[model samples]
Target: MADYPRHPDREEARLDMSISQVWAAERISCPHRDILRAYLAGGLEAAAQDYVAFHLEVIRCPFCLANLEDLDAATSAEKEELRQRLGRAADRTVSSSAVFLERLRDSGAGG
Candidate 1:
């Protein structure tokens, strides 16, 4: 083999993704984070619920997986804070899980 000019940047870019990520990305049509968050909270509508299920079961998008992990890791304090922000005392129309994300977005919390 002959020595050739090497650009480490190009080489790094070519090798960036782990095999798992590449495989997952190939299959996943990842929905938006907010939508994923809503899905994680079990608040998505029927159509969105189907999409999320497909992503999780088939594509297994890593980002949504991480977001779901975060939601599962939510502390009691965090849940209480979300409930307070949504006025759980007075507003009993919706389940907290159903509204926590929307309230977080409205409060400039980036959901």
Candidate 2:
């Protein structure tokens, strides 16, 4: 019989690899974008938040993280665009009101 040298951490490494594989497999079942968005907004219930936290922190699912990041960025961009649009509208309204008031005063209708 031949003597074989055994690595002491071989079993532990195999277990770790299997655990990682399991987590990777779970990625396919990641939560939807709505849930992820709610998680980002702190709008989810405690239990749902915990699950999302585990999926993100423990499982480290890249797809969900990327989706969350994209949603957040899009949200910020939408907000900025809305703000700019409102500002432009307000400017136009103010200009129109000023013109109307000036014409009224010039036509002796300001009394």
Candidate 3:
């Protein structure tokens, strides 16, 4: 075989590839969104919750952490929106009741 010059960064590239492969494997093992959501909601069983906690706290998987953060934010926003909607509905109900009561009084129905 003819001798060829080796690239100086070949080892570094190989190391980077190895690291990427490990990262890909870890990501593949990550729990799906539904499981993550259950974990967030405290709906998972003890064993499943423990596993998720280990993955998040010990492994510190960046992707899962980001997903969890996104889920939390979305949940908070939804709750706030629902609260505002309920508040508006309550205000409308109160206003309507007041108007009805005023009309009743004006018509001498309260006597």
Which candidate has the highest lDDT of all?
A: 3
lDDT of 3: 0.88
Q: State residue 95's C-alpha deviation in candidate 1, in Å.
A: 28
lDDT of 1 by residue, 1-111 (tens): 999987798676666445446757564466777776687778999998997897777666777788777766674458888889778655665666558878888999865
Of candidates 3 and 1, the better by TM-score:
3
Error of 3 at 53 (Å): 0.7
lDDT tens readout by residue for model 3, 21-95? 686576866899999999999999999999899878866778999999999998889999999999999999999
**Looking at model 1, how many pairs of residues clash?**
0
Which scores higher on TM-score, 2 or 3?
3
> lDDT scores for all predictions?
0.72, 0.87, 0.88
* Candidate 2 structure quality by residue, lDDT tens digits, 22-88: 7677666588999998898899999999999988887778888888889999888989999999999
**In model 3, where is the ten-residue run with the lowest total lDDT?**
16-25
> In model 3, which regions exceed 4 Å deviation?
1-26, 106-108
lDDT of 2 at 30: 88
lDDT at residue 9 of model 1 (Cα atoms):
88
